[model samples]
Target: MKLQLRLSEWQLTQLRQQEQNLQEEETYLVTALNERRLPMGSSSESIARRLTTTGAGVRAVQAQASRQLDQVRAENRRVKHLEQIARAAAAARLRDAEARALEEMTNLHAGRRDRTATTGWLDSKE
Candidate 1:
């Protein structure tokens, strides 16, 4: 048995939307972390512990989101690289075709140089 899996255009669009959401969430988390770092004045031990736990949870999420973003960026780089390679190959093929056409034209004109022999004769007479 063989299996092939690929995302449809709609699915790809959805994935892009999800990626944007993740980026937004990560940004919000970082902003929240920054805001929470300031002195909140002396509080009871339970409140302090809750704040600490919340902070730790935010940090973990930030780390995971950052990692996921890194992965997405890496995949984008790879896709871009493959696109570049394909473009270069296409350009190379075009160049090769043009070169062949030029070579063929040159060969076709090779036998027409006999007209220059008249000029040589005129030069000798002068």
Candidate 2:
């Protein structure tokens, strides 16, 4: 018996969205960091001042997004791991069932053979 891994449509969609959001946020962080590294000037000071005011908030958002991404990845891994275990268990059950069936077939054949031998002995005596 082949066991298939099944994921709900919503779960797949959510995972995709989470991945996309993480990528986008990572890009935004890189851009912001680059902007902050430019040569300091009066023009840059205004931008720097604004960045300084909102930097903590931006950092917090990035951290939260990263944490969420990690959580989603962990969940996906957990689900896949569980699926592997289920497949292995199903395979084991199938093998057990086949063994039992073979044992029963062998016992049935042996019983028939014994009956035939007994009948043959009685016929010879007669």
Name the top TM-score candidate.
Answer: 2
Q: What is the TM-score of each predicted model, taking all chains together?
A: 0.45, 0.58
Off by over 4 Å in 1: 1-53, 111-126
By how many angstroms RMSD does model 1 differ from the true structure? Answer: 10.7
Per-residue lDDT tens digits for candidate 2, residues 1-126, read 112113333444555565566556555545655766543453555545655645555565566656656656666677788889999999999999999999999999999999999999999999
lDDT of 1 by residue, 1-126 (tens): 011112233344555565566556555545555565433563345444555665665566566656655655566666678779999999999999999999998877875666677778889999
Best by lDDT: 2
Pairs clashing in candidate 2? none
What TM-score would candidate 2 get against the native? 0.58
Model 2 residue runs over 4 Å out of place are: 1-54
Cα lDDT, model 1, residue 69: 58
